[model samples]
Target: MMCGALYFTPIGRRDSCTPSEFARFENDEQKGSKGGRIHKNKKYGFKFVLLETRKGYSIIVGTWSGIAYQGENHERIESGPMITIRHPLWTKSDPRQDIPIMILTRAQAEIANDLSVSAAPFGPQEFSRNAKFVFALPPRFDYGDSTGTEEVREILRNHPLHPF
Candidate 1:
């Protein structure tokens, strides 16, 4: 169980994450919520990608910049990327008890290693074991602003995990 910086987002659906929804998680990197409280991991300066195992997609949370809610007043606070990864646990409604996974680039893996988060380079076998599909965006691409799901699908259609 490695434990370094990771970006996180929520999964509201059953088996997939929309490009737009993923964009928000990818671009938005802040430490707490609207309720205002410091997350234990905030100090670690990590960002995490949130996903559902059922959705069959995994993302690597890289560097991010944005405002986040923190403290008792729910004040808007801006901060650099903080790092962390929550352990995989199935969503309540999903009876399979599947935990979501993350895929990292070489640099991201290094960062995760620094923070003690378990991470490995993106590979087909890793993808096969962790997800049915992958966003697989390179570090240079700003996936948060990407709205073209069809274009992405076209590119990834040949991938073994793609359902289509």
Candidate 2:
């Protein structure tokens, strides 16, 4: 299963795949977890939306503060908020599981918000392509050697893709 698979683009690697390509690959795998639960349970303070693009389907995730509202033909997700959170590195041991961190991007947030509103009137389901939205991945800081920690921090702090 390719669910939650993380793709890393090493520094100075010109052949790295774009986020859109990765999303398409994951979508083609058809191993994505359903977003129904996340959509229904707003108490978690997280919002989810599923989008159908020309490449394939992509899932959008964001928080309430970042998303203003969602609806069919009427959706708005502010592209200004940045979410920094820790995520577990499955390849690592238990105690060090939470080393991986990420900052969500504006494009990703918009996609999530658009998908959420598009499905809101109907239910938790996929909606047709929204020309204004595109699939993207958040910038993730993975666990590496001690020497790379600073580099990761620098990337997390300076990457322009992340929302300000």
Best by TM-score: 1
Candidate 2 residue 8 Cα shift, in angstroms, is 8.5
Query: Over the stretch 42-159, how does candidate 2's per-residue lDDT look in tens digits?
Result: 2222322221111132222222222333334543443422222222221123222111212234355334433322212321121121233222333322335443355334433432
Provide TM-scores for the models: 0.24, 0.18
The ten-residue window of minimal lDDT in model 2 covers: 1-10
Error of 1 at 136 (Å): 12
List per-prediction Cα lDDT, in the order shown.
Answer: 0.29, 0.27
Top candidate (lDDT): 1
Candidate 1 stretches with Cα past 4 Å from truth are 1-4, 15-94, 117-164
Error of 2 at 39 (Å): 35
Measured by TM-score, how close is model 2 to the native structure?
0.18
Model 2 per-residue lDDT at 164? 10
Q: What does candidate 1's lDDT look like per residue over 27-48, in tens digits?
A: 3333334322121212222233
For candidate 1, the 10 contiguous residues with the lowest summed lDDT are 78-87
